[model samples]
Structure formats: C-alpha cells, structure tokens
Target: MYKVFFRICRYPHVVIGLVNITTGEKGYWWFSILHEEMLCEEYHVKNLKGVLLDELPQNGGWFDYNDINRI
Candidate 1:
C-alpha cells in the first residue's frame, strides 16, 4: 500500500480541499489536468474563493505551454 494526497483548487493558486488516499504511487503533481477538462468553471475557476489576482474578475486561463487559452 501507498499513501496518496490530493487537493482541489477553485483557481490555480487557490487551494480549497485536500484528502489522503490509503494506496497510491509516490506523490506527484498533476499539471496535465488542464487539457483533460473542457472547462474548470465547474470548480469555480472563475470565482475561486481563496485565490487572489492582481486584476479583478481575474480573466486568466489555466497554465499551459501558452497559458492564454481560457479552456
């Protein structure tokens, strides 16, 4: 068995929830999830609670090779 940890964020820098899994591989960051979902708005990306931005409405897209596309 392995220990695994997971976290959910309303936005990139915003961390909302975290959990531990009883079994899993060594901990690793999942930076590839951006493309997996068409949009992160469901997770409150637009209205991220804990995340703060230099500008209001924070009209920025998820990180990526380009880091410009909203989805």
Candidate 2:
C-alpha cells in the first residue's frame, strides 16, 4: 500500500486525504479527528501523487517526488 497525495480545489499544498492502493483495491483515508477510511476507485480520485506514508510530514504538506523515489 501507498499514500497518494491530494490537493483541494483552492488549497494546493494541503493534503485532504490519502489513497491506499494495493493489487486490485484502493481506499480513501481522510486525515482528520474522525479519521475515516473507505474503499474507493482510482477514477474517483484526482490530483494524486504516490508517496510512502512514513515520509509525509505530520502537519500534512507538499513532498518532493525525489523523496518518493528514494523509498
């Protein structure tokens, strides 16, 4: 599984959630107080960049593609 970055319509650096992608399944993980997770489809997601969850900042912001490659 991997963490997929997503930017809202107006906020470019903020990560609204993550997409957990596996062999043939994907799920959405909304990072919030409620901490929700749901199964979703690839097309249902947009503006995504694959990144390892461990490399992400706790505050949630932009991550360099190079960092992803290093993992």
Best by TM-score: 2
lDDT of 2 by residue, 1-71 (tens): 45765533222223344544554334333232221111123224333445444433344343343343232
Candidate 1 lDDT tens digits, 1-71: 21212334334433222122332223222233342132245444643323322221233322332322342
Clashing pairs in 2: none
What number of clashing residue pairs does each candidate have, in the order they appear? Answer: 0, 0
Q: Each model's TM-score, in the order given? A: 0.20, 0.27
Question: Which candidate tops lDDT?
Answer: 2
RMSD (Cα, Å) of model 1: 12.5
Task: State the lDDT at 16 in candidate 1.
Answer: 22
Give the Cα-based TM-score of candidate 2 against the true structure.
0.27
